[model samples]
Each structure stands twice: as structure tokens, then as C-alpha cells.
Target: MPRIPLVDVKAQYAPLLPELKQRIAEVLEEGTFVLGPNVAAFEREAADYLGVPETIGVGNGTDAIVLVLNALEIGRGDEVICPAFTFYATAEAIVRTGATPVFADIDAATLNLDPADVAERITPRTKAIMPVHLFGRPAPLAELSKLGLPLIEDAAQAFGSPAVARAGVASTFSFYPTKNLFAIGDGGLVAVTDPELGERVRMLRFHGSRDKVTFEYVGTNSRLDELQAAALRLFLPRLDGWNAARREAVGRYAELGLGELCDLPTDEPGHVYHLCVARSAERDRLRAALTEAGIGSAQYYLPPLHLQPALRYLGYREGDLPETERAAAENFSVPLWAGIGAEQQERVVQVIRAAARVPAAS
Candidate 1:
């Protein structure tokens, strides 16, 4: 079999090339390279798609979180509770604001922050709860809301999930090349339910100025540029179709018996399957097997945020978050992308089943 990539980004954009290039050319011709018309149009389109009143385009996903945090006045002495079973940027964003990140364990089934666990981690100084829609699975926002802390969704992987797409006080998205909704390069946005807060985040993404010349608060330069925004505009209308295709691929994984051999991610109506992650006690061995077959695979959050060297000062030990630790030791993502063919999926499943020595489901 030919080498199967974990994400065939080229395949996704191949058919869209003519239009994409035209969009890029328009940006180049206009010479409004930064915070121009395309960015403005994309922000409005994304805001409408997300069903939020406003969306502020920024340079990247990390900046989206930092800008939102700054707008909320959460820093220095406050704490932001989030899961340790996620990417480094989740916690890193909190620490960047001079606030301590209070790491919580994730739900074994969904790999999102366990709200019950979040409640236990909260304190008088806990300013907000940042629940990641990890791997595009919407965290339990309805449950998390009852805890009475502000919810700032780390929605980097969950662009098309409408259920939680507009639920929180604010949600952040990354338009990284591989995301469900993506740009040619880095870009991001913040969706806010409150237009007032949206304006604050908007100003913060620039130099904290409503009109660029009048600086109201000290801020950073993180504006989403015209070129990237133009690419995103081309991709935006097709986002739902691509997400649905990803869901279809995930269903195909189950039909091929991948689910029986490994713990497949729980399928929610909103899950876009950003990556079809599966868990097995023999994960390392399975990853090795996939590699031997020239098939791609990866482990998500191997170190788990709390155990990362940079965050060790938070005093988390090896066994602190049992479920998160176990997940870090076992989760492996199989090859999955929009429009992935059945033959490739079957090849991936065969490799995984062989590596685990598991029989196909009856």
C-alpha cells in the first residue's frame, strides 16, 4: 500500500486551487496585506456561521485565547481551570497572562475537561473555566455552566460544531492549516456572545486601539492578515461539508472494525472528527506497526500538560491526573481526513488490528 498520511491537506485543497489562487491574487493586487477587507468579511461570515453576534479575527489561535483573557481582566493573581489532557497551548495561554493554570483531569470518554473535576479544582481565585472541545468533541458546556464560572472555550479543533460553537461566554478558534476550518497558514478568531466584550477583544488584537491611532490599553500586534483571511473565506462556505465528510470517515473506521480493536472516540452529533483518535493499552506497539506499514499515526499530548517540563513548577506529580495520565500513555490517532477513501481506511484498520492481535468484531 502507498504511504497513507494522517492528514492529506493537499488532497483537500487540490480541487479548490483555482478559486484559492484567485483569492490570493486579489489580496496581492489590492496590497491591503493586513486587517483589510477580506479579514473583515471573513470575520462577519464566521460570526454568522457560529451564530454569535461578533467574531474578531486575530493572528493565530493562541493569540485568540490571550486576547480574550486580557479583555476579561483575568491575570496576575487569578487561576484558569482547564484540562491537562490537551495541547500545550491551552495551559500556556493561561500562564502567559500571569495567571496560574489550574489543571483538571479529562473525561475518559470524550477527552474534554471533566466538569465535576473542574468543580473540585476551583477556588476563590478561580476566575474562569476554559474547556477545550478536544479533538472536536464538544465539552459538556451545559453542565460546566452550572458551576457559575465564566466559560472560555478553547475551540481550536472544533470550528463547525454548532452545539457548543456559540454556547460559552466566548470561544476561540485556530485556523491552523490542518484544522476543520483552515487557512493557507496561521489565523484565528474569537466568537463572543456579548458585543461589548467582542469590541474589547477586537481592540486587544490590535495595539489596544479602537482606531489604531488612539491606544486605549496596552496590547499586542496579532491581527489576522488579508491573505490568510482570503483563503479562509474561500474555505468557509465548504466548512460544513468538509466536517460532514470527516464524520463519514469516522463512521467508516467503525465499519472496518477499528472500533472493536481500540477505544474509538465517542460519536456525538456535533463531533467533526478532527482526528479519529483511538485508545489501546498497546498504543506504542500499534503506532510502531502503523509506521512499519508506511502508514501515519501520532500520539496526542504524550506528556500531558501538567507533566510538561515547563509546567512542572505547578507541583503536579506523575499520578496527579490518573485518567489524563492513562490517556497520554495510550491515545493514538489513525489516518483520517475529509474525503478519505475506504481502501486507505481499511488498510489502516488492518494494520491496527494486526498490531494489537485483536479479532474483528462479529
Candidate 2:
């Protein structure tokens, strides 16, 4: 087997090289760089694609979350219920806003924030619920909506997934090179149905000024660069097709009986399959076998966010969140980028099967 990467962005980008070069040339020739025509154009296109009225592009995904919270007026001593199993940025945004980030447990099935756990954590201080669509599947918006608090979707991994953007008060997207819809460098977008909130993000991204000289609020300079926007425009048209390809690769894993060897993700329509993850008590051994076979694998997260030392002040212990703790320990993602071939997939399964001798817990 040849060497595989956990995410082969080069494989996904190669076929579109000519178009990327052309678009990048146009941006250079125009010279209207920061938040220029290309940036505005991508915002309009992304808004249409996601079924939201507006999309405000930002410097990166982390800033997108911060912009959304600031617009909502959530700060200082307030609480935001966020899942403990996600990237630190979700909770970090809250901390930066001076709000307490109350960590919630995740559902073992979807590896998403558990609604019941979320309800248990809610208090008068709770301002919003940020349900992360972890590993490219939508979280339970229906149940979360019933809680009567606004929802902010951390959709960094769910860019092309169906109905994910439509579920929350505001949905955030990351265009880091690995995401389904991405740029050559880091970029982000915040989509919202409400024009007022959309305008708020627009102002918040550029030092809180509606006009160039007037500073209306305490905001940061975090606009998306026109070059990255132009590059992303090249891939926007092919996003669904690429997402379909990832889904197909995941199906091949099921067909090869990899599920019996480890815990597999569900084949849900809303899932864009960012990472073809599975759980195993033998996860470490399996990763070693894949490495020896020149097949790549990664632990999506080894320690859930609540237990991370940075958030130790949150006062959580080892057993505070049982499911989140277990997920961090047992789960790891396998190689399944959009352009991966069946032969590469077969090698991944073969290596795992060889390593999964003991019966794994479901």
C-alpha cells in the first residue's frame, strides 16, 4: 500500500488546478484585496447555497464564533452551553467574551451534544446553546430548539451537509483547507436569516464601523481576504459532488465489513462524512497497524474539551462526563477524503481487520 494522509487536500485540489490559477490571477489583476468584490460575491453565493439571507465572511473560523456571540450581546458572567467533546474554539469564544462556558455531555450515537445533558446544564445564566455538528453530521436541533434558547451551529466540519445551516439562529463555517468547502488558506463565514444580526457581524468584523471612520462598537478587524474568497469560489460549484464522493468512500467501509471490527458512523443524509471515524478499545493498536501498512489514521480528539488543562478552572473531573470521556478514549478517524480511491480504502480496511482481533465493544 502507498502512503495515505488523514486528509489529502492535494488530491482534492489537483483536478481543479487550472481554474484555481485563473481565479487567483483575476484577484491579483483587480487589486481590490481585503473584503473586495470577490469577498462580497462569495458571501452572496454562500448565502444562497446555505438558504440564509446573508453570509458575513471573516478571517478564520474561531473569529466567526466570536463575532456571532458579540452580536447576540452574550458576555460577562453569562453562560453558554457547549459540548465538551468538540474543538476548544467553541468554548474559547465564550471565554473570550467573558461568559462562562458550561460544558455538556455528548450522545454516543452521533458524538454530538446530548440534548438531555444540555437541558440539565441550563440555568438563568445560559444565553445560548452552541450545538456542534461534529464530524460532519447535524446535531439535534429539534430537541435543542424546544429549550427556548437561540442556537449557534459550529459547522466547521459540516459545510456541504444538508439542512445544517438552516437549523440555528446563526451557523458558522470554517474554510480551513480540510473542510468540504474551503480556501487555500484559513477563512470563515457566519450565516444568518435575520438581516440585523447579519449587519451586526459585518460591523463586528471591521472595528465596529458601519462607515470607515465611525467606531460604533468594540469589535475586531477580522475580514476575509479577497484572494482566499476568489480561490474558494472555484470549488463552491463542485462542493456537493465532492461531498458525495466522501459519502461513497464511507459506504465502501461498511461494504468491507469494517463496522464489525469497530464502531462506525451512521449513513445519514445530513452527514457529509468529513472524517470516516470509528471507535475501538484497541484504537491505539489499530492506528499502529495502519501506520506500519502506510495507511494513515488520526485520533479526532484524545481528551474531550472539559478535561483539557486550559479549561481546568471549569472544575470538571475525570468521570464528570462519562460518554465524552469514553469517546475521547475509544474513537479515531480513518482516511476518507473526496478523491481517495477504492484500492486505498481496501488497504485501510485490511489493516484494521488485521489489528482488530479482540471483539470491540459497540
* Global Cα RMSD, each model: 1.4, 0.9
lDDT of each: 0.91, 0.90
Alpha-carbon deviation at 153 in model 2, angstroms:
0.7
TM-score per candidate: 0.98, 0.98
> Across residues 266-357, which tens digit of lDDT does each residue of candidate 1 receive?
78868878888888888888999999999999999979999999998999999999999999998999988888899999999888877886
Judge candidate 2 at residue 315 and give its lDDT.
95
Which regions of candidate 1 deviate over 4 angstroms? 358-362
- Give me the overall lDDT of model 1: 0.91
